[model samples]
Target: MAFKFGSFDSICGQGALPVCPLLGTSQGIEPGCYSRNVDLGGTIIFQPGACFIHIIALIMTLIMVLHIRSKYTAVGRKEIALFFYVYAVIELLCLFLDSGIIPTAHVVYPWFTAVHVGFICSIFWILLANGFVGFQFAEDGTPMSLWSLRISAFVVWGVSFFVAIATFNGYASFSYTKPMGLFIVLLVFPIVCVAIYVVSQLILVIRTLDDRWVIGDILFGVGFFTVGAVVLFAFSVTVCDAVEHYIDGLFFFVLCMLLSVMMVYKYWDSITKEDLEFAVGDKGAVWEVKECVVPSSFPPSRLASLPPRLRVFEVVALYLLTRSVSLPPSLSVPCSHLRTPTSRRRTTSLRTEEPEDLSSEEWEETSTTAPNLLEETTEATLPRDRVKATEARAASKGSTTRTHRREVFGTKKERESLLGRIGFSFFDASLPLSFFL
Candidate 1:
């Protein structure tokens, strides 16, 4: 049967109201009515709001294509760029179909059917490309499983497209009728894929402490799409009628436009001025500091090697890794060096040389022995030997004085709290909670 907008109003007549679908056909007239809209090439074409959403989608696809082509040179990124170009082409075609620029039917019926099916396939391709891009950028590295994900999304969309076409042609039937069934499949599949990508992205952000710009962009896009999808799904299921459908379509359109603008702004510099390298370089520096400040990777056995006071600092360092803002370049370099095998061996050796307890006699002996040890070690043999010697001498003097003070007048927890205060202020200034949301 042909669908017409405002059909429900006509059926109700002037003074009468439409019955509620949820309250049963026998129930009194309800205040709201469903709109009658025809599905053309798998898109609802009667609603201007949906048309607007399609236009916004096309703009976003174009921006992504240009951004990737200009800023990224990696082999994997080039492949992603190609996918985006194809996505843009298909989206533009779908927009034309919805706009009636392309005729809905032809003398050869199968030709029309093929065009309709192609439209649905194109939408799926765009979604697949979007998911791939999110996954690629969120990881802050090349996707190792790029080929696998691409192949999987392609297979799913191909199968779903043919199934939708067959249903439209009456060759197949399902419990919910073919068109609705196809809609449900298409809607649910992408939602599932996007959800997985978002969760993976969240984990990557937490673990690596990457910049929020990339994470925030993906979250906003996915969040809007998800809300829009839920509303549309409810409308399609007959839980809500035509008016609800139109309202939801309007909301979706507005959200899509907002998402498009967000994407553009987030990548504007990288896209226009070829500054992705600089942005990535800054992110790398933060990631390096994050790795250094957290010693979670260290075994519990290693903690015993450090002096009691230094052990407390290690604990402080761990806490800072979790909450500190902007790790200094100085700390990052030493932390990286310490993680190396040779550097680790040297640390172990130094710990072995440290006395269990520092007495005045022990301090003098250690201080005299350090100079002699320095002379014995060749320049090549101990690249960091001089620095280590200087630091060790300072630590020895400090520990000896502190120990004497404690023995003479009972010690109190007199450790300076500057690091904690500095960490708090730095974190507050650099990352406000508003940025995360």
Candidate 2:
């Protein structure tokens, strides 16, 4: 029996490569060996899926990066996420250089050298993303320094530079022997570092779980943690064969895109401590959002300021508690339908661009129903009509009492119209006929 990837292997047949499986099927071995000439080139293209996945991830990355920079102030964790994309682009480019995947992808000796360099950069990025989550976790109450983030990033770049140089010099031949040293540097180091960083960040967030932002940060950390786990599993396992290379990368890129979207949504508003309130009781806890206050002026640091001092239960509850908005016991409109009838259905009062998808009777019924619904809402909200003007009309014409009263009680408190007797507030000329003038 063979390890089948759907009906793909059966259809595609054998592929040309040294990178393909040792024994394609189980029958090859007298006891356990299995060999079948399966077409892996058909299974995995020369460019592989990572380069394409990179394109998708790159687009997502750019949209978020542009949105963050243009709409909001500062970079923070979102900027860190941007590095994930940069790494993707670099990794894909390196693969193209080695495999001649891209159009006119000329494979030079230097390019083969660059494959090792690109691998180092990729590792650095994963570690960087992991470390950023840690930095975000540390941002409770204190203003996280932009300078620190910059410095750390630059340091990673510097280190990546040196590592690339070393790899270029040491591993001259592309097909170097099975290197235990490369394994330690590539697989073990990044995995251990990422694990430590993520776990530490989790611990930090838990310690100061008061801030809802912290909860968001925790989610971000978890996402990266999963990415790191997948990467580590793929790299560390000898039998896995680099997670089938292209397939693993495709999965990884897509996962990052998903995580990036969520992170963008979570941190969109750039919320402060004032924006949230915690309501804890026997029914568990819920985030009581007042007016969600986004900072008009961000601090010098792109980093979000984490809120201080929360119960441990809040942290645990954050994990248990869902991220969805709390719905009313009875929703006015179901989730399936978001747009109100007012937005979708046209009223006779307002002529819409699109024709109504209804018959004459249906249109009439709909138009009528809309007004009645509005009237019901208005009637509930509006105060009872007091006919003061009507009362005055009948009271007196001979006596100036009604007139005097009209002059005295000039305005109604809750009147919709702005027809109240507004006395002249600022008169440029102090004359008797100044108001009239």
Which candidate tops TM-score?
Answer: 1
Worst 10 residues of 1 by lDDT: 14-23
Best by lDDT: 1
- Flag clash pairs in model 2: 13-38, 13-39, 14-38, 14-39, 15-38, 15-39, 15-40, 25-34, 28-34, 29-33
- Write down the worst ten-residue block by lDDT for model 2: 414-423
> How far does residue 304 in candidate 1 sit from its true spot (Å)?
66
Shift of residue 175 alpha carbon in model 1, Å = 9.0
lDDT agreement of model 1 with the native = 0.41
Model 2 lDDT per residue over 324-358, tens place:
33434332121211111222331111112222232
lDDT of 1 by residue, 1-437 (tens): 12223232222221111111111122222323233456777855543454566677778777766656555433235445544554555456545543444443432333333344444454445444444454355432245455554565566556765655454444555311224445445445545655665666566556654565666666676666656544432333242344455433333534553464345335333222344554443233422233434222233334444344334434444445545456654333223323222222222111112223343353334334423433433342232443344445556767664443333222221111112222332112232222211
User: What's the lDDT for all of these models?
Assistant: 0.41, 0.36
| Count of steric clashes across candidates, in order | 2, 10
Q: Show model 2 residue runs off by greater than 4 Å.
A: 1-48, 74-85, 91-99, 102-152, 168-175, 178-181, 209-437
